[model samples]
Target: AQSVTQLDSQVPVFEEAPVELRCNYSSSVSVYLFWYVQYPNQGLQLLLKYLSGSTLVESINGFEAEFNKSQTSFHLRKPSVHISDTAEYFCAVSVNQAGTALIFGKGTTLSVSS
Candidate 1:
């Protein structure tokens, strides 16, 4: 079984400030990493993924994360956030094979104050 842990449940910051949301995971088998963002009252959308080849991945909206195999962590970060970036972020993992469902962390809500 695989499990994910998000260190922070909520993080508040002023607009245009930098932020980081920590994530760690453990799996008995090889897995793919993903970060998804959920806006208020909406379903999650994929932000980025670490499938293979690269340890670092980035989202279009200025967020990035690195897959650390030794530490079993995949932490998300953004250099400068915006009010529009306020949302809940989830770190997830899925086995490399089909028929395995994605498992998610509880989530970290990023509140950007203007």
Candidate 2:
């Protein structure tokens, strides 16, 4: 069975500080990884994804994640975070087959303070 693990349930960082939301997984078959974020009082949004081609992917808001095959991980990182970055982030996976459901991690809450 494949599963995604988000070790850190909460990450509190000051404004303009660096942050990394850890995400790891175990899978026997080829899969696609994604990071989803939900802002305050809003639905979940697709932050970034890794399906094929490059192992590393980035979002417009200066967030990036790398797909490490051997390590079986897709950790999201940002050099400097802003107060606006505070939100709930989730790591998700999907099988290549069409109409497949996505498996998501517990989710990590990022709290950015000024």
Candidate 3:
């Protein structure tokens, strides 16, 4: 079984500032890590994922996450955030095999203020 934990419930940051959301996981077998963002009243959108090849993966919107196999961590970071980035972020993990369900974290609400 695999489980994800988001250390913070909420993160408040100013517009254009950098931010990092911590995520940790535990799994007996190899797994795939992912980051998803959900806008208000909208479904989750895949931000990034660590499938294979590289330990670090990045999204188009300035978000990046590195897969640390030893620590079982995949923390998300943004060099500069925007007001539009305010939303709920989730860290998820699933078995490397297909047809497995994703186990998500509680979620971290990112509030970007001016």
Candidate 4:
């Protein structure tokens, strides 16, 4: 079984500031890591993912995450945040096998203020 843990429930940062959302996961087998963002009253959208190949992956919106196998961590970071970045971010992990369900953490709310 795989489980995800988000260390912080809420992260408040001023606009243009850098922020990092800590996420850790535990699994007996290899897994895939992902970060999803949910806007107000909207469905979750994939921000970035670490499937294979590179240990580091990035999203189009300046968000990046690195997969650390030894530590079992995949922390999300943004060098510069905007007010529009305010939303709920979820860290999820799924087994590499097919038809596996994703196990998500509680979630971290990013509040970007001016």
Global lDDT scores for all candidate models:
0.95, 0.96, 0.96, 0.97
- Alpha-carbon RMSD to native, per candidate: 0.8, 0.6, 0.6, 0.5
Global fold similarity of model 2 (TM-score): 0.98
RMSD of 2: 0.6
- Candidate number with the higher TM-score (1 or 4): 4
Across residues 1-114, which tens digit of lDDT does each residue of candidate 4 receive? 789999999999999999999999999999989999999999999999999999999999899999999999999999999999999999999999898898999999999999
Judge candidate 1 at residue 23 and give its lDDT.
97
Segments in model 1 whose C-alpha atoms lie over 4 Å from true places: none
Clashing pairs in 2: none
lDDT of 1 by residue, 5-84 (tens): 99999999999899999999999888999999999999999999999988989888899999999999999999999999
Candidate 4: 10-residue stretch with minimal lDDT: 93-102
Task: Quote model 3's TM-score.
Answer: 0.98
The TM-scores of all predictions, comma-separated, are: 0.97, 0.98, 0.98, 0.98
User: Which digits, one per residue and each the tens of the lDDT, describe model 2 over residues 1-114?
Assistant: 789999999999999999999999988999999999999999999999999999989999999999999999999999999999999999999887787889999999999999
In each prediction, how many residue pairs overlap at the backbone (N, C-alpha, C within less than 3 A)? 0, 0, 0, 0
Misplaced by over 4 Å in model 2 are none
lDDT of 2: 0.96
Candidate structures ordered by TM-score, highest first: 4, 2, 3, 1
Candidate 3 weakest ten by summed lDDT: 61-70
